[model samples]
Each structure stands twice: as structure tokens, then as C-alpha cells.
Target: MIPSRSDWTKALEIRHGKSLNEKFSKSTVAICGLGGLGSNIAISLARAGIGKLILIDFDIVDITNLHRQQYKANQVGEQKTTALSNNLREIAPYISLEIKNTKIDEDNLEELLLGADIVCEAVDVAETKAMIANEVLTHMPDKYLVAASGMAGIGSPNEIITRKITKKLYISGDGVSDVKNSIGLVSPRVMICAAHQALTVLRIIAEEFDL
Candidate 1:
């Protein structure tokens, strides 16, 4: 069963503090890409008590995604955001969720980012990821960006470094790896990157880590 607000408050108090939990429960985050990184990050944020989430993804799940993504194999062929939304609701029923089963582009980028306290770029495509970064940094300079890159293939876990791009932008994962090389991805590395992204989101929300 989903935990109640008071239960969440108590848990946070035990884990962090009441002040941190309050900040987390009041923040809104938008996650672009419902694949491996985005899926794990979104679930982590929801379980941590983020009050609202806006999830966007254009593709449907495939058997290949089951290796790293949090969705079940039965969800194959279903829209990415839709399946993730169902999963999150099961985890945090009291939280508000918005799912956009469409591609994030110049046209709808603003709408997708509207009212989002922080935007996480977990998409796979380089072009779309760069576009979102430029759009967000240009229009909403104060908003935070937690992005993942070079998460493909098995590499040194120490290679994944979380760095600040700007006062409002942060990136995690190795800088050299690429999906084009067919480096491939396994669950461990993807989840590591996702954890970094989620922790960055939490830090941003709590004002503990400034850009």
C-alpha cells in the first residue's frame, strides 16, 4: 500500500529531517525519456515523496529495454511514459503525475517544461538531449538540469562522475562512452547513473547542492 503523508513525513524525519521532506513534497520535476535512466530516476523520486512529476517519452517498450528499465517484460509494446506512470502510481499513489506520450521537440518543449521545478534529461538521442538543454538553459536559466551521458557499455564505475555544467546544470556518467559504438548497457551501470541523477534532484530540491 502507498504510504500516507504523515508516514512519509516520519520516514523522512528519520532519514533526513522534516525540513528536507517538506521541500521534497512540494517540488515538481519533469523527466524526459522513460527508458532505463529516466525510469529508475522517476521511480526513485516518487518513492522519495516528490509531490508531482511530468513524464515524457515517445517510444514504446521493447524486449531489449527489460534489461535495464524498471518495467516488466509484459509491458513491452506499451508506451514508455504510460507504463512508467502506472508503475509510479503503484509506488506513490498520493503524488500527482502527468504523462506525455509524445516526442520532446522545439514545438512542445516549453509546454513539457512548464511549471517544472527541475528537468531531468534521460533521453537517449544526442540531438534531442542537446536541444532540451539549450532550451531550458536559455529560457529557464534558474531551473536545474540533471543529465546522463556515456552510460553505455560496462566501464569503470569510477568513471561516472557527477559534474556541474553551469550553476543550474549537472551531468552524470562517463564522458567517453557512446551508444553508437554498440557498447551496450547493463542494469548496474544504468542504475548507478540513475541514482546520481535522483540524488542530484533531491539535493536541488532541498537547496543542499547549489547548481
Candidate 2:
């Protein structure tokens, strides 16, 4: 059944007030990946009632992703964008989303990410994160990015933190872990970092905390 407007956002409206809800409902977020950090951040943003979302990922779901990402076993082999969309739609039936099943690179980053108020850098590799961060942080005046690092393993959950790298760039995680053979991403620590990224995005939207 389609949820009524009141039923859909009753709690959010009560907690955040109408103006904040309106602000969130009018902002757009572009999530550049659908891995553990990106997927969970996207889920939190949808739950927060962001106005629009741009989802981009080139990989297909794999069994290995089940431990860290938001994907399920049944979704294996499906494109990440498609699988994530299916899940987001279930929680927020009317959330606006744009899915791109293509890998992001310097060639098309600016064009593909246009109109986003905030961009969440959820990709795994250090090089890609630095590349995107350099571009978004240096050039975009109105755009902001939340990136993650060192979220692997069941480390101290308290260690997963968000710190402002610049006026427009925020990095989340313990800032030490890497997915080497002996160490790897775990669901709890990864999700904790995802929450930091998601909350940072929301705070950026809220415009309450000075970046």
C-alpha cells in the first residue's frame, strides 16, 4: 500500500521540524559507489528523506560482498545499481533515484555528478578516493564530499570517526585499516563508518555545522 504523506514522514517531521524536513527533501545526493560504505550511506540518506539520489556503480553483486555491503545472496550477479535500487525502493517507496551502472573516472566525473548538493565518495581504492577528492574539494564551491578510510576489521567501533579534511571534504573511519590478506572489511566497523559518512552528509545538508 502507498503510504500517506503523514504516515511516510510523521516521525521525521516531529523530530526535525518542517523546515529541516523541507531542506532534506529538496537536496540531492550523488553516491559514487555501492560498496559497504556507499551502499549503507545511500540507505541512511534515503531513510532521512533526501529529495533525490544519484547512484553509480559498475560492479555486479558477488557472494563476497554479502558480509560488508547491503546486498543479499539472491542479488548475486545483478548489477550493484540495480540491486541497491531494489532495496532502497522497499524502504522508501517514492524516493527519487538515478542509477548509473558505469565506473566513475576523471573523464566523466564532473558531468555525471552535476546538480548534486553533496557527493559521497564510497569507492574502495585509495587512488580513486584521492582523485575524486582532489577534484571535488578544489573546484566545486557548492558541492561537498564525504569519503571513508580504514574501515576494515572489527576494530573499536568508537575509533570510526569523521573529521573535516577541508571546507568541503569530510573523511570518516579509523584511518588505519586496509583490506589486506590478514585484515579486511567487517560489517560492524564498515557500517559504523557508513553512519559517520551519512550523518556528515546530513549535517552538511542541515547547514548547521560550519564545514
Candidate 3:
């Protein structure tokens, strides 16, 4: 059986302190893409008791995604948005979740990300990443954007670090590695970058600015 909301947050409150837990429980986060990076980031935030999540992705799980993504082998044919939502609900039943199984473009991106306090860019394509960063920085100035740059290949995990770009934009990763030129994405390095993004979001919610 699922635990009560108060019971569920009681442990998180102990770990995060009541004040921080309250902040986490009141914030809404939006994650774009549900691939390796996005999936790991979503799992981390859900476990942290993020109040609401807007999951946007248009892909379906494939057998290949099992290696680095958060999906199970049995969910290969399922839509990513639905699959991730199911997983998040199992982990944090009381948290609010919003999912969109459609591609986010210049037209609909703003509306999809409307209620989010923070936006996470985890898309694989470089152009898409740039578009998301530009859109959020230009139009949604009030929202914090945590994006990844270079987490591909089997590089040293320590290379993945968060950088504050502007007052509202933060980037995480080595800022050099690209999958097109590298050997490929390794599970650990991708997860390290995802963790950095997740931690940056948490830090923003906690009002812990690194600057």
C-alpha cells in the first residue's frame, strides 16, 4: 500500500529539513526528453519529493534504451511519457505529475512549460538543446533552466560539473564531449551529468546559489 503524504514526506523532511522539504514540495519542474539523461533526472527529482513534474517526450521505449535509461526491459514498446509517469507514481505516489506525449516545438514549448518553476533540457540533438535554451532564456525569463552540454563517452565522471551561465540558466557536463565525435555515451557518465542537473535544480529550489 502507498503511504500517506505526511508519512511519505516525513523521511524526506528529516533528510532535507522541514523548510527545504516544504520548498521542494511546493515547486514544479519540467523535464524535456525522456532518454538517458532525462529519465535519470526525473527519477532523482521524484525521489526528492518535487511537488509536480511536467514530462515531455514523444518517443517510445526501445530495447536499446534499457542499458542507460530508467525503463525496464518489459516496457520497450511503451510510450516514454507514460512509462516514466508510471515509474514516478510508484516511487512518489503523492507527487503531482503532468505528461505530454508530443514533440515540443517553438509554438507549443512555452505553453507546455507554462506552470513549471524550472525547466530541464535533456534532449539529445544539439539543435533541439539550443532551441530549448534560447526559448527558455528569451521568453521564460522567470524560470530557471538547467541544461546539459557534454556527457557522452567514457570520460572521467568528474568532468561533469554544473556551471552558472546567467542569472537563470545553468549548464551541467564537460561542455566538450559530443556523441557524434565520441565513442558513445556511457551509462555512468550520463548519469553523472544527470545528477548534476538534478542537484542544480534542487539547489535553485533551496535558494542555494553558487555565484
Using lDDT as the measure, the top candidate is 3
Query: Over the stretch 75-145, how does candidate 1's per-residue lDDT look in tens digits?
Result: 99999888888888888877899888898899899988888999999998889999999999998876889
Clashes of 3: 0
Could you say which candidate leads in TM-score?
3
Ranked candidates (TM-score, high to low): 3, 2, 1
Pairs in clash, predicted candidate 2: none
User: Which stretches of model 3 miss by more than 4 angstroms?
Assistant: none
Query: How many residue pairs clash per model?
Result: 1, 0, 0
lDDT of 2 at 123: 94
Q: Tens digits of per-residue lDDT for model 2 on 1-211?
A: 8797677877678877889998998999999999998899989999999889999999999999998899989999999999999999998887899988898888888987999999999998778988998888777777988888888777789998888877778889888877894367788888999999899988988885564
State, as a TM-score between 0 and 1, how close model 2 is to the true structure.
0.95
Tens digits of per-residue lDDT for model 3, 1-211: 8898788889899999999999999999999999999999999999998999999999999998888999998899999999999998999898899989999899999999989999999999888998999999999989999999998899888778899998899999999998889988888998999999999999999999884
For all predicted structures, in order, the TM-scores are 0.94, 0.95, 0.98
